[model samples]
Target: MIIVGKVIPFVNRKRELSSLNNFFNSDRAELIVIYGRRRIGKTELIKEAIKGQKAAYFFVEQALEKDNLDSFKEIISKTIDNPLIAKADFTWEELFQQIAKEEKLIIILDEFPNLITENKTLLSKFQKIWDEILKNTTIKLILCGSSISMMESYLLDHKSPLYGRRTGQLFIMPLKAGYILDFGVDSIEDAIRVFGITDGIPEYIKDVCYRLNSGERLEEVFQQDKVLFAEAEVLIKSELRDPTRYFKILKAIAFGNTKFGEIANYTEFPAPTVSKYLSNLINLHIVNESYPVLVDKERTRNRRYHLSDNYFDFYFRFIYPNKSEIISTDRISGFEADYNRYLGRIFEKVSEEFLKLNTDMLPFRFNRKGRWWFRDKEIDIVALNDNTREILFVECKWSSLNQNDVKHILELLKQKSGHLRWNNDNRIEHFGIIAKKIQDKETFRAQGFVAFDLDDF
Candidate 1:
């Protein structure tokens, strides 16, 4: 009675699947913790991993403890072919003891935070259960949740009772840019457009794909009454106690207030308050704090915050700001030009993903890659191999570039590379450009420059 749920077209989680399968096939008991933002496909990945195995998948709901326990009992009875389980009222530890009796089984408690929220002592109880009963058995226990904060504080944090109990942990991330093409995007340009909004999140990509297939204009998907119009607000409210404050902070960052002082001034919050809120958002992976590439993070005072979640960035930038207009008029006015400009940044991210996937295209394999900036100068992409003193500087453009334009950009990039203080004298320098379209790309390549366009993606 191990039900394999309806299968969807799984895309691009090869490493995760392999790790999960290895844990499933292992000789020892496994306590695996999987967590990510909502709709990032944690449950689907778990279901896909446990396919054809003796597994019981119980979605933990927010309810009374006894009510949830009864639901878990029912699932267990059907999964293990034991009618007595349906009749007996068992505690969490007792139920886990019964699960351990099986020779081999996978127990996936989806939304595990719900369980811990109802009964905080469940952490200590589960810790005891694992140590006393299930630790010696062949049970592959998977605890999954969407509340990244709760999951980390309750299960993954060093101070928690369940700390040191997890045999493995997987932080499920969104699919990279290349996977967007698998969703029936007609071209890399269309894919980049989709990626700018969805950020390669599988569920969001599916929604965009459906709308595209149904002939809905891309902008129309974010119109009033659409699925994603208010999704960012909803997700923020669900995850944080103070959504309004976080929304202000996120909006500030999305609108190019990346520096700490600027975000504080824009949000009108005290500096200390801003730091605390930013820390919380960073823990949830909604905000990303980054330093220049190859810079010593601890030593450098230069850092910037960005909305790492693309959908959130799009929401704050476009949907949230125009909610009133969209509701009244059913359209966004004057967004096309700004959206295209936003795609310039998104295309840079897409280009970075492309570089990661095609590292062989570079002159030397790079150990580190990221944006580099100092005062007035910035490079779109900088990749370097510290061991070999090899460096690559690249520019990303969302518009088509002809030969002259390409040369100008490469020349500017080379000049800016002079500012990066990483082994400047001994470094072997390389230059590259990625754009929407580049004319005569081979001609540039023959001159020892790395150049690519949408066609290469």
Candidate 2:
């Protein structure tokens, strides 16, 4: 057997795919709805699950209704091993009815939103057909689409024709940290660094690996390829009508504006208009809104927003904006220069997110986790354990930590602790400082503060 590379089959979705299979192995037919943003591996998952089975695959195009119906009919006829239907003309209803009457028939309507757009009454007609004929039959109908809004509107929403008809809806997302080891990426920090850049979308991760060997840097591979330069644009342009506005909003978030008002001001759009766009963006899972921890200030303008997906965050931050500079110069050198300039900041943020992921291993889960400011003084991290009433104060320094760094963090904690009045009789406060490389480990240990070096992971 001449295998090219390791076939990482359905690398991390064993449980999800198994559950979906279990559901399909039931008495009657099932209506499964699967969707996600473009290139997030929806089709791959479905195809892998339905491999070697009696499955009909129809990828609906943005075309005329009659043409789409013809295409769908062709797939259905071919799937059933019917050679004669290549010359036969069948309407959508008749073809679907024939499929419904069969056993173990799986029909996948990919890009269903485009089909619905091509013909406005397709879902209503589908609902009528399902109610009258297909519902009682044994045809497993799987509808798939990339347009998050359109998919939700047509099937998942209350005001849609196919609402409440779906047996299961699967929103496929990118891979997370838990799957890093399975993908053959070593070390949690290294895995997180990859996630920071590639964002765990399988296609993006595979692309990164295709160019970069196991020990190679992403900036090297990403800068050499113009394909990655316009990747973010390609993803959004396919689904969104006006890419510029969404791009501006995304860039604003990537540039470090976390609140709606901040993003609007930075992007120079009106607040209400920005809000509407944000709603649409969040609905598509491109961006997310987060309320402050330990605070119920959601309605009082305290809810911050960011790109929910990590890959886009990396793209907007480094690749998309720096495309010309990267491609037009000595790719590796230019990339290294830019990377060295900003990698410290990126690592700090990654370390913070890592801490969130490993809270189970921590001494306490803090109710509040964020940076705090008072005039010129700033604290990098503050987490209060509401349950245990213990406080965790952390300071992250990219360079080697010095006496000044320790003194600064201690001063900030002293100031804030008194103001908040959060001390019990126990007064068990845990202070921690993280560095890219630790300095004076004995001194750090003497101070009863946890110090983490970048190599610790």
Candidate 3:
């Protein structure tokens, strides 16, 4: 079982932490909304932000509404040194009014969606409370939840009752690849391996770090009973009601059926059904649809669907297919070659992140970056500035490349660039390569090409 509150080192959320603290220090009342997928460190960031403050945190459980209210009252009573709060029976509005009596208070209702799910009327009720009672007070009311759809529909949507009432909203995202180094991994490659498995989710990274520091092999982290093995199913089931169909569609994409017709054929589902399911997955941020770089997504039919979360990508690609054998044998083996090929795709993602962080390596700062392809010709990484007509093409290889290999790959990249019709006449083109290791990388850099390796990471 995964342990809670294990004291993993918080790596990097400097901007988010600063934003929350600013809300805390504000003189007026604050209604903040915090949300993301499960185990993406929403709660940890809040805990860090409210470290020594006068805050009452209540994790709204999947229980009765009265039970959650009582729990909230108990927490607030203890936190604010008011025994009267626990003794008095009050509604959510009354409870907030009682809490608002204290100066500069922070009231956190985590899993706020659970409360709304149990009692749908709470949305308008809370809206009334905010407008009538809490708006004039100094209480910082925070509503956080893991249910992205529910949160967006009830709190953020324009037609919702709580619309236009929030002082600020934070949609927390996963950490980037570079932050993996802070987890005590020995090298950049090790960090990438961890990133491929954990997808920069802080809790999963902590679990992997704990296991690795305890002398366990990284492969052992994927054992049948481990949290990582079953996390994808839990996330999907929590978000989607009919998860079986979604699973088939996700597996289809995982197994290389990315096109609309390809997924429909593989799953044997109708085109419209596949479209609806893919839309749901896209909304949850579990899958992403992409067109070639510089192509308008709406105007193009040449789009492909891919898993957005790295852990989900790795899980569906490897674990879901061989789950029975892994469960029976209690180990994973004989997939190193295939796993390395999977890492090649992951390396492309890492290269994109690296280029974004180190944009000075490019000719001019790029405003757009993505994979580009036309017919059978594909460029791994592409960055462009529409205004300046500066474009960058990069090839990412998960294996080592010698001088000759780099030269050959650059030649192919240049040939493929001819197919791109963005600004063929006036576009200033640049080329580069990122790999596991590049021989004489400085030589390529001296030739005015962006060159990077694991050493640079």
Minimum summed lDDT over a 10-residue window in model 1 is located at 1-10
Query: Top model by lDDT, which number?
Result: 3
Model 2 — which ten-residue stretch has the worst lDDT? 1-10
Model 1 residue 8 CA deviation (Å) reads: 6.2
In the order shown, the candidates' Cα RMSDs to the true structure are 3.6, 4.4, 2.6
- Superposed by TM-score, candidate 2 places the C-alpha of residue 337 at a distance from the truth, in angstroms, of 5.6
Residue 157 displacement in candidate 3 (angstroms):
2.6
lDDT of 3 by residue, 205-302 (tens): 98897898777777788888789999999999989998999988998898888889999999999888999999999998999989899998889899
Instruction: Kindly report which residue stretches of model 1 are placed more than 4 angstroms away from their true locations once superposed.
Output: 1-8
State the lDDT of candidate 1 residue by residue for 262-354, as single tens digits: 999999999999999999899889999999998899998799999987899999998888889999988888878899999988988989989
lDDT of each: 0.90, 0.72, 0.90
Going through the candidates in the order shown, the clash numbers are 0, 0, 0
Top TM-score prediction, candidate number: 1
